[model samples]
Target: MQTISKNITTLLLLSVVFSFGGCKKFLSVTPSTQSVNPVTIKDFQEILNSDSLSRTQFFPLDLMTDDVALTDNQFNTGDNFYRRIYTWDALIWNPAQIDFMYNYSYAKILQMNVILSRIDAAKKDALNTPQTKNLIVSQALTNRAWYYLQLVNTYGAAYDVSTSKTDPGVPLVLTPDAYALPARASVEQVYGSIISDLKKAAANTDMPSKGIDIIHPGKAAVYGLLARTYLYKGDYESASLFADSALTQESRLLDLTQNPYMPNQLQDLNTNPEVLLGRISSDEGFFKTYSNTFVIGGSLLDSLGGFSTADKRFSNRFSTSRFSPGVYKQNQLNAQTMVFDNSVAVPEIMLIKAECLARKGDFSAAGDLLDKLRSSRIINYSPSGRTYTADNILSYVIGERRRELCFHGGLRLFDLKRFNKGTPFRQSILRTSYSGTNYAELLPGSVLYLLPLSAYVLAANPNILQNPR
Candidate 1:
């Protein structure tokens, strides 16, 4: 088992160097009515690495539902329904969310397949030369796995213990072959496939430190992703352990005191030690709502005790400018964002560790691990300051996670779904329609987790299984 894992990791690294794409092409692609393979690494990378591509293709429902604020659209069909559909706090996501996803990911999958096929067939000299050959292959495989993870998470149902084998999930697209539009597998199969990809990544890749350039995923990033996958699997022990592995490589938070809060600074283009992976994955277009000037959402505000002044979170993490009676300030989008996209740093690992520990009922270790994070970012570190109980400690941990991690592109919706809180779309909406909803309104057991397989995918591969609502 161990030997196989190592060989796969080596392959993943070769894949990364092989996985080159430009920002523009990565986001958008028009698939052939019939299955076709892209010609080269550059072509394949263009589609896979694109921010527009990733935003549109990578993970569609993440923001629209509630891991973060939904981008406002005049189109009115998307996140707009957060309030209405979730009127019961019952989350009925846009079926159309699956449209971009199916197209983009399969396009990526195809590109990867072409690369993989070429890798297998290329002359030994071409494949072995440049030292980077292995790196590129490793990258390609990891990215392919990434696409699968996103597709499954959005479209598939939660992985249930007893019924996962019987439950519906997204199609497991391994080969980019045109003939292979597969059917929906069980949720177990989807996760199993993701694990396989990460295992490949972990074994084959060599992490390049954030020395000259830091935006790309290398060894640590893939390992971190593996840790994340384990967490989602509810394998608390493995999750915490894998997260530790990632952290051991790169573990430091951005120094709030010394660093400037200017837009460029947030990127830490240096691939600051704080960041474990690529600098950032650009979301499509500027995020609709988040700005450097953050306004408190009424739900968040009320939860904060009263004024933005009331919660240390509002005061410490964000700089607020008031407009209406309820709304406060949050991140405002502008030009500098393009130069530096979203980057994942070490605190994510800390939270992963803390949460996984808490899940295991190891409250003392979890609380200790979690509080240390709060202690650093915040002033006045009295353990009992926030009225500490195990649950209180956990809530504070999550609250800190929410406040500290917002707009930076961390796991907000994952937490929601993991905890089964996917329905209540209410929090901080400038638009009233989406606000005012509460927890009880969100229908937890409803078919909320399912995502429709897009028309494009169905058209291309009539065989692809649809996740039924």
Candidate 2:
């Protein structure tokens, strides 16, 4: 079936498994019509292998960021929910319409929950032993934790250590009961659970360093998720440690200078050795669709342009050919086929390490790390001779982060949100519409950055309150 359920309750009631499909309605669950009850280890593996789960992360959420801009025509005629998100509207969806972002995320969570709930009792044989069950549990936990991170970052406030305990996060549904109407957990609680799940996954030494495919979460992927989680929580030291641990397992970077292929290594997950885990769009011709609707924002294009022509990413990852004369759009989000790679790649982990070092006031080390990454993507890249100070190092890394991770997985938005939590890292974004006359500015403290809970969800479950407008 194409859809799981109509709302969160239905999502809890059913498990969705399928070839990739549209995100039109992925929110609900109905056992009678769409559920696949897992009774065997092989069955659980099949559920985990479904492409639908990979497509459930923040791929579409990029539409809301400063890096993308809608044409005036598309702004008025495109997906209504996306149009609202583009302008930071207080409400992006009506009570009747499905919030695919919310639905798809919880849909994956539901399947993970289903597996976790059933895997223990699943039949074991020669190939499926107790160790196999442990590995399966670990993968499910890791996948669940990853999806929760996406949910909390999108639906909750930017994580502040001082306030996360009180900030409302998305619901923490850990069971397979379709009738469960879990209340929103505190951001702290959600993060706590995420860390706990990832830690458990990492503890399972029996798991492979890498999986059979990128879609599966291996030890490296588990560690990568941990690093990303700790980074979001502003625990830079922990982030750096886990990032290092992850790189120890998988550190290959796709050298843009050496790859002469038309699409390059970054476009295909299978070809990229750097990818620790793979999550992707629905192979739904997303870029082709985006080309018709949006252009890369001028400011981002300018930032990409400022990097020297030696920088292969700027040339290979983007193009003006998709749009009119001067308008540019990202080209490497996916290959000619579809499927955009949203995996936690080595570059992102490297960037994480670099940012952590900069935060520790080790500018020289941070710059060296940053330069190492730049050298891989840019030919004949010389290390910066400019002396670095605490004043500029983090900002420099942040800029590099925007360039390196932009449009990858709604990451720029996440970076912006986290930076706004406090201090010199705080940023403000002014979003100008396709028509320059209208503008919406998101300050460091603006509630506009936080997406509200889906109205349909609120109407269906009274326990779940909406985020502050």
Candidate 3:
């Protein structure tokens, strides 16, 4: 158990002061002063809406996976931090290498905890109406759940029903007491907390129907997050139901064909029709380095299928890298600096529904859903010659997920962890060396899937255990 005072100190030092130029509506109410503690619902809402705290990056996870390939020159010039992650080396033991994500995630969680603890005091002070209080509580709960999910998935083992009870998860801190000390909880406990929070959020009907700003979590975003959580848990039925609910609430997919390219303007979080919940990564500049170092994997490019050139996703989302002539870099976001999209979008919900249906043996239903998504992403996509049977439906759905969400937010790694559970679906991840002569492989049940905790965390808390190297 680490003292919460230490945690608070670390959080304050690492917190980024986010500017809200694009999200004026959501944060229209200005705070009195930073010196004053947040006691009003509006103040808390602004905290939740801060993209600086909420937006996160899992760039190391992307490097660990197979979707990215580094050029020889780029690899040699890259820092030891990234190289260590790419090779899954013991060098990652240094807190400096991975502390940004650890600190950033916990900082947001700490804010949520503070808001939750103070909401009652705010209510007593008549700082909020019933509706505003309920909304505040709901938003804080969901936001906390989201941060915990990110922490658990990165630090703990993949959620397996049989093993989750014993799997070491990140510490669960639910209060704002800076002096309180808490120990790590099991993976099962972490997920239980997440589900409980989401359920409470779902019951808060007073919450705004949609986010005044995309960065803030709304009703549809809650459903989408629930769907993602269940999908990771392998609860396909619940995942499907939640995905459908989310789609019904807000189903908007941008027609990429109509406007194939937006070089200077990559992510339109303010007006993007497809984004249900918009959150960018703190490492917005890392995208430029990532593009300089890595290119799309050959196998990943091949999986795009016959309409690769014709598909708007292919034509609009990628371009030849100036850094490496033979390499193609992801261009979905900023052309110069990549801004990773951590939002819940229409395509993800559709894929979740498709996957759940396939898992339930509803091949036709799943195919129909896949086609609907495909039609939107690909120009003139039709089902006339395509066939998706039960035997291959799951494969198709998985392929679509991979193609649709390659470098979105380490989603490929997450999916790999979930799908690697069963013997039939289990697969290995292999990455070749710079020369392509040697390969590093991560087996289905490899401990490497669970990232090692930052050395600072272990040093501060003797009770905390590090993931096996």
The segments of candidate 2 whose C-alpha lies over 4 angstroms from its true place after superposition are: 1-12, 15-35, 76-79, 260-267, 282-293, 306-308, 321-339, 384-386, 433-436
lDDT values, one for every candidate: 0.53, 0.73, 0.72
Candidate 2 lDDT tens digits, 31-142: 1123355578777766666545565445456766778776776665666655677778887777787677788777777778878887777776665787888888998999
Choose the strongest candidate by TM-score.
3
Error of 3 at 347 (Å): 1.3
Please provide, for model 3 over 181-268, each residue's C-alpha lDDT reduced to its tens digit, 9 standing for 90 to 100. Answer: 5678999999999999998998898876577667667888888889999999989889999998888888877777676633322235
- Candidate 1 lDDT for residue 402: 65
Better of 1 and 2 by lDDT: 2
Question: For candidate 2, which ten residues in a row score worst on lDDT?
Answer: 24-33
Candidate 2, residue 59: CA error in Å? 3.8
Candidates by lDDT, descending order: 2, 3, 1
Which candidate number maximizes lDDT? 2
Error of 3 at 366 (Å): 0.4
Flag clash pairs in model 3.
5-178
lDDT (Cα) of model 3: 0.72
User: What global local distance difference test value does model 1 have?
Assistant: 0.53
Model 2 accuracy (lDDT, Cα): 0.73
State TM-scores per candidate. 0.71, 0.86, 0.88
